[model samples]
Target: MFKEWARSVRYASKFHRKQEIVTFMRQIDDLEIYANLSKFLCDNYRQALKILKSEPELKRWMSVEGIDDYDTFHVWLEEEREYLMGMEDGLPKKREETVEMEYVKRLKNLESSQGRLSSILKAERAALSDRADFNPAPISQVACRHAVEHRNRDAELVQDLEVRLGITQQWTSESPEWILAEKSIMDHRYLDALDEIERIIVERLFEMTKIHQSGTRYKMRRHIAKALQARSKAIRNAIDRYNTVAEEMDPPKPTLSWEEVVNYGFLAEFDILRDTGDSIRSRPWTRRSYRVAMDRYFKILRAKEEIQRLNIEIKRVVTWIEDEDWFLRRKEAEYKDLNPPLAVQISRYRQRRARSDYNHMQRFWALAKTPGFTGSVVPGVSVERQQARHAERASRPQTSREMEMEVVDERERWNSSQEGEWEDDDDEGEEAEQEKVSTLMYQMSVLAVDQDDGRTHQLD
Candidate 1:
């Protein structure tokens, strides 16, 4: 409080560095930075310790009652320089405009990222709530509060990132896709868990920015990519929602279905059966056998496609898990309501279903082959219809045996031609002449009557 003390604290009131001078100052654990203050405090340590020990609240505030009380006191005394300095209203205002400005710079950096994200999340939630028989529970107020609190938190986080990444200007979303990678990472859904947020936040933010209609000059081909991202996102969300249900509720067992699985496996159209199988094989998600997994995946997502299929998969998942003694009690009361249980009668059921499916599939193929069934991959089309269309081309006229024969014949002809040309072309004329001369000389000898040099040249 004295001029000497003020002078000790400030000496010159100079800052250590530009950006985080205060934080750095606050972080200084040594008495060296405040050597002047240390001397001033040391001169009065005895009296200060004596007076401070008397106050119970002060002792509790710093837990001054213990053996380390002096240590706490000294540390607090030094670090509290800022706190103590604040008490003096006129104590040379040490506002770090640069720090605050740096924070503002951070917010600007994340502006586009935050803008596009929640709009999508909210839109999706709203849509899901609107469907017939769909009951949308208002996001739990806790979730709502989280949503609210998250705004500020995200803002702060983005700001912090800008500072850390040394980003000065806001990223212009060059293409919707450029932002998509970042934006997708921000999504709580895409993340393994909320705890993984920090690492993925920037990633999602980028993904979000990628799909935005507004792209910056710095970006390229990003629009097309983002357009694809949007298309894939539309399908992925539906699949993800379908997969979250418990196994017993669906015909197929619910399991981990990542974006890579759905995008490459389900939506990728096969030139033959949409050829998604090959793509599925190549994906990072392809480690496990996906045939059964695919059924489960289809089951969960089928609700969005065919409500009937949706119901079937849901019941399958629910029942599989619910019926622990599935082996012992193959048939049960629960199986009665829907299409009859496949039970241990799976083969028999399959035979019947196969007959029904064959008829349906046959009809589908007939229709598709008839040329009127347009190639429409509409968002609103029934999943069964989609499957029907694909199944029509399932065998895909596999290059026909007739065609294979033609290929073989063509190959044989080519080989025959190649075989005739295999000789040493450079010496052909020389060999022909040698043989011709041998014949001609024999004839010539007959004509010449033994005296011509040609007869003698024929050797023995």
Candidate 2:
């Protein structure tokens, strides 16, 4: 009877200990989930703050929705993150009976606190979601959610809609309308004129290329080219309008010289010279004509600079697209194998955005390539004089090595003259004259040494 009682007590103790361990593990899993949720909420809060700070209009909208004081909200989020991190760090590692009990109690308290915080976060997220203009989630997250919710819909159409929606969101987020509103009427008109020019150039290019490649189509091609030249008059008119507006807004000050405005007369050698002939010096130049010439000259310089900038931007965008394409392609192949619907949708959306950006850049390149759209002729001047002046400036000795060589040559000349003087000096005053010469030479050597030291420091 005693043996059976002891066996029963042992069995009961084992079962109870197993039950305790199982409960402890369940608490651990729950705490881990709570920690993850806390991290997620913190990230969302951070993203929200970033969005609000960037968009003042959105902040106003949110204020209307009763979520004012982002600074306080940001502080609260930071505090919550730190509190959760502390909780995680303070969790017990040892599995002693006393430590386990203490850990369980702590976890229970943490659970209650986390539950309350989670509820608050959920309510805050709901408030943000209620505002149509404010979405804290990234483009990918939004697209993924949409894809998951509407998996039964047409995949391609859904993807396209997501891309369009993303673009609309981006456009609104940038608030270009506000930016345009800040510009003057003249600026708006100038932009419209530029758009018209771009449209004309694109149409002309399309018309010229629409014909088949054959000998029979030669006349058609010629007709198209001639017709496009007719549009050149329209282009010229638009450019005149643009120039008038630009000159008004940026008017050339009297202090600016022709060389300063026209990149040292390099631009004068172009089509401008053809239109004005060699009459720049011969004509009775008035202030009005000077201002007009300065405007056209500056426009040419601006166009050249813009073209170079656009080329660099295009190259950078192309490189970015290539890298993005490689990454998305790999992601897409993985998605195909795994058949993860949301991942596939997100990848497609990214690819669409990249393609759209590339097309936009290419259009910009086309617009930049169109000539005679920026401005008309620079005042004609003597190209030979300009060339000679530019050449003289270029040929001037400006390098450190050249300066050093000049200094060495001067020192050699001085030394040779001193030697000749010494050879001619009489013995009576020779000692005194030699001392003076030595003193002068020492000073020159000291200066040379100082200059050499300065040059060495500059190199270093």
Candidate 3:
């Protein structure tokens, strides 16, 4: 009986401790801090509760002592404080002890997390070494050659597009758009860089088409031309914008335009004499040289576009994170509680408060039942046992024979249903045949009766 009383006190203490921790968490202003602490406290509470409830001695004493009233219960706990603390089986740990232990546990967990993260990094590094750090000289020789050839063709196409657009490499290098784009990237102004790229691309496309007089069979030529044009314009714009902001001088003046370069080529025609003494080349600049330059320019343009795109996407993601942080802080300040614990606290408080004004007839006759103060709450053993049984059933694995039996039962049901359907069809056919035979019999009987009547009339 005394053990049961001690167990009852332990149970009450566990409940009180949980209530206090939950209330403390609900009162906290910061959701993040509360969230971190609440889990620790809740885990401790659950462990303590489990220990207190599992004591079989408490169940026996609960029926003997009829101390169900809240006020009486608290008084009993206060009077037996020393005994309650002395019990080895169901006592809750002190707050200081619990906190100190939890701190050590968390520290160890943090160290474990760091170790795990480091191991992951090491694994990833090893994978990168195997995949990306190997020599490419032998493996990529053929592919590299093909890539170089393709790049050369693209370069030639870009050079043609530039010539048709009436712009030179020198003019693009000096353009305000190109200059601004490079400056923006250096300054880490990714949005500005993106804007510059857009402007450069649009202007180049518009001007290139305007200046274009002839069409090419290769459609890639048009795309390559536009990409190069946009890239040049964006770079110039970036430089121009950067110069204006930094108060820096503009780049050296452009030496030539597309028309000037073309006209000069025609005017300054220097003949190349071959060492063979008989064969002579007309000029130093050939179609092949221009084609090689076009390929290089195309590669440069693609690289710039990809770099600018990545920079802009990264900046946008950073901005979104910042906005989300601000929003959460604002909401936290504006509301009393924005998380689950606060809601739970409010509901719990309301439920307890609602029971405050109740007048129990049983309490009034409490003195009559003073010798036997039993608790209203049943020991949760039966309930836990039932739950365990349910969990076991749910988790139990089915044998292969059981699975086969189930399949067999399903097939049998399906076969029976098919047989039922066939029987119904047979019954309908039999019913139709019976009706046809009955009709024929009735027709014959009527004809016979008619013939007999006719004979009698004739005899008369």
Candidate 4:
């Protein structure tokens, strides 16, 4: 019996301790604190949504809980507050001993309801915080915007260059060099296409340089170079913008580390006794602030990607230009070395040969017009003998094999005659004949050079 009495006393002591703990919890009004926090979270979420709605571009970046949940929680909080106010109003005007137990029971039920509501509020706040922390939609939206802007800017710069070059026709296909290069590519002559493009670029550079030297108004190279400079400036501007946004959006670090905030309460264990600390104190950012920061961060990433691509493209073109410039300089030096003296000789030779040909033609015509003329117009040849020889040769009948052999012999004789023509000339005439041969060679070279120049001008 004494042991049973001792066990009852132990149970009574435990029950009293639990009652004191409950009373202390109720006095702190943790239920009200949780409700206020939930309301604060709801307000922030609503404000963020409003801002997102105003900016359609930014709307795609927000990922959060639905408004209906917040609405429901708010309605419940309001109803519970009204019920508590009504209960306070209905409290007896005079403290009646007979109604004390009833009042106590009603108060206990209200406390229980408050406890349940506080738990619900705490759960809601946790959900909202988790959503705010983890969403990446804002970052994705910023990155997409950055990439789009960069692409548009690049296109605009390219269009401007095209306009300035007067090659703005659709696809810029009207440029003869481009057309030839494109045709070569279509023909599966990749090396030819590359050569054509390189040649055109070198020619343009050379022409521009010549124009500059002559103090002319040629601006094609200047425009192209300007566009390249703009591209470089755009890259720098993008990088600067990215850096500025990053600095602007970067939030100050929280006083407490994440580990500390999670492991210990806002005020450590003291928060439990005081019950006045807020969970939000541990976090540095709200949902909207965090999202905006992430957006800027992602924008920086996209800018970096675009900058890298631009750098590669610009570097490739610049390298090609440098190589073409070197090639152009070398070719110009070669042309200067070989053309001037040779061209002067060829020109003088052509004038003399033309006069000689005219005189020979006039003499031949005059001799033909003479009534009794029988001699060949050509020097050292008899016309009658030449005609008789041709007639005898034509009259001779021969088998196909003999005919073929005769044709071969004729070719050999013609070749030998041409080879001995200069050798048969007297020493006094030898130098003149050699000059004629050299003039013929120079004519062929001039014709080829003229054709190439014509083609190059057509390309221009």
Indicate which candidate wins on lDDT: 2
C-alpha RMSD of each candidate structure in angstroms = 45.1, 41.8, 43.2, 47.1
For candidate 1, write residues 44-102 as lDDT tens digits: 33333343334444435334324234343334334434433443342222223343344
Local accuracy by lDDT, each model: 0.37, 0.43, 0.38, 0.39
* TM-score of predicted structure 3: 0.13
Write out the backbone clash pairs for model 2: none
lDDT tens digits by residue: candidate 2, 1-460: 3354355456567788577567756665544542243234333333333333434454554466465554434444355345334435333122223322333333334445555555655755776777766545576455545544444333334345436444333222145542333343334444454344334444543555565455637778778778876876765665566456545554321222222322322222222222222223232221233334334433444545654454344444433543444345446545654765754574556545544544443343333223222210111123443464356459874554235334434543544444324223363254344334434543454355346435644664
Scored against the true structure, residue 186 in model 1 reaches a CA lDDT of 30
Off by over 4 Å in 3: 1-144, 153-157, 160-166, 169-177, 184-189, 192-460
Taking the tens digit of each residue's C-alpha lDDT, what string does model 3 give over 305-411? 54345334333332332233223323432342466445344434433322221111112122112222111100111343346445645898754423533443454
Clashes of 4: 0
The best-first sequence of candidates by lDDT reads 2, 4, 3, 1
Q: Which ranges of candidate 4 are over 4 A from the true structure?
A: 1-59, 63-297, 300-305, 308-460
Rate residue 366 of model 2 by lDDT.
38
Per-residue CA lDDT of candidate 4, range 1-460, in tens? 3354355446467778577557655644443442243234333333333433333343333334222222333443455345334434323122222222232333334445555555655655776787666344676556545655555555555455456556535243465654554443332222222222223233333444554575554476576556545554543443344334333322411122223322431112222212112222242222344335444434544544544453343334323322332233334435544774553444444444334333433333343233322222222213443464356568976444235334434543443454423334363264344335434543554465446545644664
